[model samples]
Target: MGLFNRIKEPIFLKESSNAEIQIEKLKALKPLLNPEGQNIIEQDIKHLEYGIVGEKNIAFELKNSHMTMYILHDVYLEDGDISAQIDYLVFTKKICFVIECKNLYGDIEINSAGDFIRTTDFRGRKKKEGIYSPLTQNQRHLELMKKLKVDNKNNILTKFVVGKYFEDNYKSVVVLANPKTILNAKFAKKEVKEKVIRADQLVKYIKNMYEQSKEIGVSDERLLEWAQSFLELQKEMLKDYTDKYEQYKIYKDKAVKSIQKIIPTVEDKKATTIIVKLPVEETEIFKELKAYRLNKSREENIKPYFIYNDKQLKDLISKMPRNNDELQAVAGFGELKINKYGNDILKIMSKY
Candidate 1:
């Protein structure tokens, strides 16, 4: 059994645009509520405060821009037993930014295997610690979006988001909202950089996305309407640390989780649809990936095959592993290579 017990109604925690106002409201209501209710509210506020700060940092940067993007904050949704807690969902006609905010004030580093390490400078003494990867956490949100038909296939993003015809693709991003903190995930490949960024880089990163996606366009008015409908349709669910720990500790996928893990781009799906008789290594994408690997291998002074040979790269192209475990399942991908270069390979494959 799970740690959560169900009553008649689950008092889903409230999400707020203005954290200060909501915090005050909760404080005012504390004395009038039951002990349990009050405890839940307190926990929500305690945890959400940090996240909201980070989100607002991103928002403040976006506010000055004239770009046609809709920004939604604290989107807590529920569907049966599953829930998705999103910090910021910034949407344009062409792309959706599913941003996970990290409000850490420190130097941070994440290896290719997705191990996260942070060093906080406090009183001139640096304290270092390892934490779970937020990249993995944001991936769950993307899956939830896919399941809800908000991403990928169907465009009925929310019941209340009327017209019921808006659609865009998702790109998972982990944002470190403290500019003072230094982040070095440079060990990752070219494509992986877009997924992780510091606060100062957030606006520029978004602008880059806008530049790339300007071809698929939506008007500013329609985008704002969609944003409003999203805000109205948001059904509060568990989004706090205590709540996640108590329930949904694992992101459960009932069916073939392998196919679900694949984050194929529109181009990739199109490429797969075409039947090519060429050997897997001779395929256009496979060769591009091989060339990419050869360049990296030479820089590291290792054999190109050490990264992945023609056959191994072909296997990767065919299987399209989205995560470390799936990549490990492919032939010739041992634990060492999976830890060292699995993410880059996955990122490359997901694109095409």
Candidate 2:
């Protein structure tokens, strides 16, 4: 039965993604936002689109692999307060694979200590930065799956055996979905190298793992049943994709109101005049800020506006946020941006 199943082509049990919906929602909200807010929303949409394309690349490979497997895309699982949004789950006759898809934009290097560093080159300059480990992320997803499986067993013996079986049969893989990313894993541990691979290498990697497994293969029916058991654990996420943009709109509105109070508009019968003035020293700070933005944008190989547009840059200079908490109070500096560039921004402001 197992041999017969192994000859069949792979099938996807779940493939639809909510990212498309989120993108559409963002597009609808973009026009309603101010110029600065619109820029930030556009960046969010592009990031989500890249993620969708990466997942689709992986999907295309799985559909064409001709191996016997059941695949699930975008499986959201929750166990009490702990939740995981897994990119893919593949069930073969002998093993279940938990995959984490990364559609990164730069060359990646894995050190002997298991740190993942990303390097991006723009023109002649190259910048290196540490990125979160997809391998570690996938391991957490696998751990959740293992705990759920073990807890489902009726007896202590069955629970222990299930836990042990899971450790042996379940595998975690980090697939780099971007075709152009160069992965340097030679310095990494053997275990780390084994867990990460390019999108094109995924099918071959799965086949190798399947062939090496000592567990007996099951029939297509049993394989589907096993896959279904895990599928049943998937929880429908009720996330409001527009929440952040809505908050941005509120912040923009408040900012506009605050500015209106500071610089009142005067109306006359034939003419209306509004006077605006800024400190002379702000000119130097603006130059420093723009230069910093340009350098950072080049290093990341992204548009300068993606970091912060002229309006947001002026806002930053006006607020002169001293720390992460103060930076968050500014309209465009979210947690991600704060964590990535906050300290550098503060240091520059400190000099002034």
Candidate 3:
């Protein structure tokens, strides 16, 4: 949901008024309250208090003082559908910024390709697993904002991963359990500047956006439609996995793995696509991937066909071979592997 949706609506708007009554009814009902979700909401509420420190009027006047932020939670912009109900939509006179919040835990790394990987310490044994990258979703949100033709001045739309337990390995605009540690690290590394917004500032910015969106007569019709469509798509996507814990876990992990995994620009320019089958013993797939490339000449297709282990399948999707010549250049490409995995390799290409 966008940031502005969280605030109480203008008591006058007919739709908003009815929505408010429904929300109140839900609150009054006993079975509907989600205990765990409520706890997180409480924490977020507390953090928000600290995030917005300055007065509304003064914040607007100061340059770099108040960044109008619209708070959106669990928003999904899928197939042109907007995901969450907007928390609020903030429109500063100049630019509109959207803040999408995901309440999560652990340390995360978002690669240049926009893949999200989270690191966890389970019983002190560290492990890493891929998850949905917020960067990809944020970009989709930006596209929605553009479709909405929100004031063009809002050039920067950023995503935040908030939780009490994220490791501060890298400096970012992350809200963690230790605000002082984050600040100190920023200053000590001389990397501490304006990139990070304090919690109070975050709240103030969101509030500012909410008020401004109201003044600008922002409409949520399109956004709501987008939200409903996104929800449906999510259900469809999740249907492939079985409900069994072990069975579904693999799908869950892979579904997250696909997030931000494919970059269309890189795939578009490929002149060749090669499909290869790797030897079973080798450890590093990319090394073998590179070796396959070294032996091939430039005249061939830019795409590579790989019939390697199941582990290497996802990587190949992003590196799809452009043509038959490139497909033949892969590590274990032969008449046998080609005939056996040919259709499978073509299937991967079709996805992009």
Candidate 4:
């Protein structure tokens, strides 16, 4: 039944993304902020634009694949406090692919240990840094999907059967959406190399996997039903991407108002000088935190951003977390990270 009743082309159940909405929101809020705040917003807009272009590239490939498939873009799922913002979910008759898209501006290398390293050239110098593995990230999404499916079963036997089926059927893929990116994965493990591929190779990769699978293909109707089951599990994400910018705008406005009231009239002989402190980026604590990150990166032979990015650093400064428990409140600081660098970070924050 599956051989004769296959889908002719890709059918997109949910095609839109929230990234476009975020870009519009940031642009509207940019004019209201000060110079520093405006600069931050500009950087965010550029990042979002790059991501949008990458997703579109993937969409174009799937649209022109001429294969039987169901595609969902920008799916958000939550299991209790944990959440995943998946880039693409491609469903076939025999397998479902959970894809993570990276539109990076540099070359990528995968070592034998499965470590992801990115190298970029500035002027005549080459800078190399380790990046968080997209494969690992996509694997987490797959695990969440498996748990959700297994938990839905009422009996223990049914749960066990469902878990094993999900493990065999679901696949995780990391797609580099940047066409110009140079990938060097020769020394990587066989499994790691197969899971990572360029955007242009996505169609061929899926077809190859489909052909190798021994599982029987379902009809087009069954395929749609399988895809729709996941679509029904999608939840509305409550995260506000523009929240920090809004807070910065409020802080800038208050500073301006305070300066206005303190200014003296022309009749006054001595002019009052009210000095407003610069933004957090220019403070001594910020510099020290950056220095610590660089030193720690060197010590661990990893990228500085892997420990914490610039935005996360600023969050630490603003929140001034004094212990491991408080540090957990910051984004990206999981149990492993807190246990690894939590004490040192707390010590640094104690100085100021």
Go through the candidates in order and give the C-alpha RMSD of each one to the true structure. 22.1, 15.2, 19.3, 12.5
* Model 1 / residue 140 / CA error / Å: 0.7
Stretches of model 2 off by over 4 angstroms after superposition:
1-7, 238-241, 250-352
Best by the lDDT measure: 4
Model 4 C-alpha RMSD vs. true structure (Å) is 12.5
Model 3 ranges with Cα > 4 A deviation: 1-84, 150-352
TM-score of each: 0.51, 0.69, 0.29, 0.70
Q: Model 2, residue 335: displacement in angstroms?
A: 32
lDDT for every model? 0.63, 0.80, 0.36, 0.83
For candidate 2, list the clashing residue pairs, or say none: none
lDDT tens digits by residue: candidate 1, 135-219: 8898887776655554323444554352243233567888899777788887765556668898778778877876776345655
Error of 3 at 343 (Å): 53
* lDDT for each residue of candidate 3 in 1-352, tens digit (9 for 90 to 100): 5434632332111112112322333333323324654444345434443323222222232223333222222222222223322222333332334443333345655444445566778999988888764434544555553443332234534222212111221112322222232222222222222222433455454444345442333245543433333233221111101112222121223222222223335656745534333332332434444455434323354343223433334334323555655455332334555666566556545554
- Encode model 2's per-residue lDDT on 238-336: one tens digit a residue: 233444554457334322112211343455344444533334234667778889999999999988877776656766765677888778655356666
lDDT of 4: 0.83
lDDT (Cα) of model 2: 0.80
| Candidate 4 structure, TM-score to reference | 0.70
Candidate 1 versus the native: TM-score? 0.51
How many clashes (backbone atoms < 3 Å, residues ≥3 apart in a chain or on different chains) does model 3 have? 61
Q: lDDT (0-100) at residue 36 of candidate 4?
A: 86
